[model samples]
Target chain A: MPEAVRSALAIAGKDLRLEFRTRTGLLSAFVFAVLTLLVFNFSRDQSLISTTDLAPSALWITVAFGAVVAMNRAFIIEKEQGAIDALLLAPVPRGAIYWGKFLANLAFVGLVEALTLPLFVLFFNVPLGPALPGVVLTLVLATIGFVAVGTILSAMVVRTRFAELMLPVLILPFMVPPLIGAVQVTARLLGGRPLTEVLGWLRLLGTYDVVFVTLCTLAFSAVVDE
Target chain B: MPPEAPLLEARGITRAFGAQRALRGVDLRLGPGEAVAVAGPNGAGKTTLLRILAGLMRPTTGEVRLADGRTPRDPAARRRVGLLSHQSFLYDDLTARENLHFTGRLYGLGDLAARASRALEEAGLAARADDPVRQLSRGMLQRVAIARALLHEPDILLLDEPFTGLDVPSAARLRGFLAAQRAAGRGLVIVTHHLAEAWGFATHVGVLARGQWAQLGPRPASLEEFLAGYQELVDA
Candidate 1:
């Protein structure tokens, strides 16, 4: 019931309500992700490339791009309505605003990923039965990394002329580290490699998440203050 | 004991964007029950000054402080200031009532429903409270924007060209509402180009030219006198 938490939740609730009313970001991202899975499924010859080998890269790529699409609106909506100024004028700490947007983006990307995971299975014939838990963990960590960077970068680019073009360009470079880490762990999990063997990748993802989330949170006030 | 300090004070505020200076050593002080009108030509930094005063932007030099000595950048101080800029700042997808409720919650106000309903009624948007902001006309949007700004009942209100898009009736209503706020002893700073309108309400008038205050003093006895004085200052 702390004020910060309450404020953050209020922000998240407002964003979620807006998204529910329009479903613009979620629907577009979901469709884009599904199409990505289908293209990957159809382009590859089943005999040459195994589903397990392709699934990790394809899934991670799809999620990353889909996440970018979702994050495109994270700050754009605020900027379009000039609501960012309203938000900045509030008494809440700037970090809470960043976290609120981060959480909302996380949920959005998670939803897209959840809906796409089933289609990924249907198209790739990759059994997620035993590896589900590990895959989920990797997805969560990787998403944290994606959204932390995306949330901050989205705010940075929202004011620019080429906001849509700028978001992916600015965010993709930072996303490389986390995406690589996620794909490797996902490949390992799908291949039945021991958890100990993929520990290093998980650690990398965790470090990326923790470092970027902290750095972005700290940097948000400066970015929006301008 | 010393008399209470002004509700808001800005000392030596200067702002520059790259090679261009927008504000130059501006000092302003507003006390309770005083409404100051700032009039300036285009590119005179009136909006910039208001933004700095609202804590939405940092000054290149000097600082803004509340009566309690908290800097404008302080969250606590921000809670005491309300700003209505040229931008409505309400979500196009959200209803008028929702916008008020959302802003009220951001300020951590209790009894949100009652407060939002009251603001809706005050702004005369009660019937259309559930309609999205994008569906409203410019005048209605301005009214809702006013409601949103006043939802928290801040001690100081900073308005930038609030009458820009309002219809005649809406403008008159806003003028009346702002007068009521002034009567209630809230400090106000309004930036506008409408000399006569500002002269009608402002207890003090300031003329900003080329990022500097060319004239700052009491309101002239008549609109004609104020216009003549303003023309003399600008022409000089």
Candidate 2:
């Protein structure tokens, strides 16, 4: 791997290993995603719109909500354990820290997405075909977007009181455009509809990723500084 | 004599948060190996001034110049100008070694383990090097915090209440460490409201008041003179 990517993965890998060791944040997020999808199955009308019509929406809504939950606890280990200051004193670019965080968050939320994807097909019975790869692609791209904003916001809200409540309240509204965009593209992909139909939302999701990743990287030095 | 290159210098640095003025037109200089203690009452701009000097917060009105005659470039400068603040500035989840290695990576230090191991020793945390900071006692954690701060081998040291909550032994050891850093030709600035130890080891001292500096100079010609000046400020 390239040096930059190696560093990025190490950041992600370390967080994953820590989470695995502590079973602090990631486990709950995974269970929460699975349970959320189960609730969606019992509550929603499966017949009105082909579950496929809403499959993308259901999956991403699950992912988005789970992202908030996962992101809330993302820095808990660092903040509570006293590791944050250690990370800050290091000579790594603040952007590297942000990416490290983003990747960790991306892995966490991606695990939730991965778990729910099968259950998404099982419970909602969304039709799957060659579009399986497309759905996976959409999930990864949207994970990057989810993590970019969530990572920056998590760093801010974690230090404040009412962290758990504050994160979702702040994140869910901002999550809409991309959440809708992810769902729309997924629906089109699963339905085997023309890419042209979903391209608008696809572009919207792409744009959200670019703008947020850039803004967060630039503003991150303030978040880490004392 | 000739201004001595002011190891770290700030010209007209000003920062205001909303309506409250944190710092206003503050200019200060530190020469090589000078340890300046910044003293002020609560609400004084001591913390704000240190933040600006550390390059964490950009000054609204002035510039911070390094002794090398250049703009404060990046984290490396901030790393070199170390501050021991109320905050530990560490990663709580990672063990001491993990924490140090992370920082070592940032400074591009080759042989991360060597740097980290040496720092752990310097902080007197070698025995507890593998323990998570959360599990360490306050004093041990303080030592770890010091090790983390010194991992990069900074040229200037800034301490903001470094002694807060430390036991006498820990503080004594810390005092020795700070003294050694000063002896090594690094500029050190410490800000504290506590008078007893604040004024003890420092060579040069500065008093900050109401968003401005009131006085700054060498150690009192006599210890009694330092107390009288500090007491006057406290009573004022």
Best by TM-score: 1
Give the per-residue lDDT digits (tens) of candidate 1, residues B116-190: 999889888889999999999988998899889988999999998888888887788888888888889899999
At residue B178, candidate 1 shows an lDDT of 85
Task: List candidate 1 segments past 4 Å from native.
Answer: B1-4
Tell me model 2's lDDT, rounded to 2 decimals: 0.76
Worst 10 residues of 1 chain B by lDDT: B227-236
- Best model per DockQ: 1
How far is A154's C-alpha from truth in model 2 (Å)? 3.1
Clashes per candidate (backbone, < 3 Å):
0, 17
Error of 1 at B181 (Å): 1.6
Cα RMSD of all models vs. native, in order, equals: 1.4, 3.2
CA-RMSD of model 2: 3.2
Shift of residue B193 alpha carbon in model 1, Å: 1.1
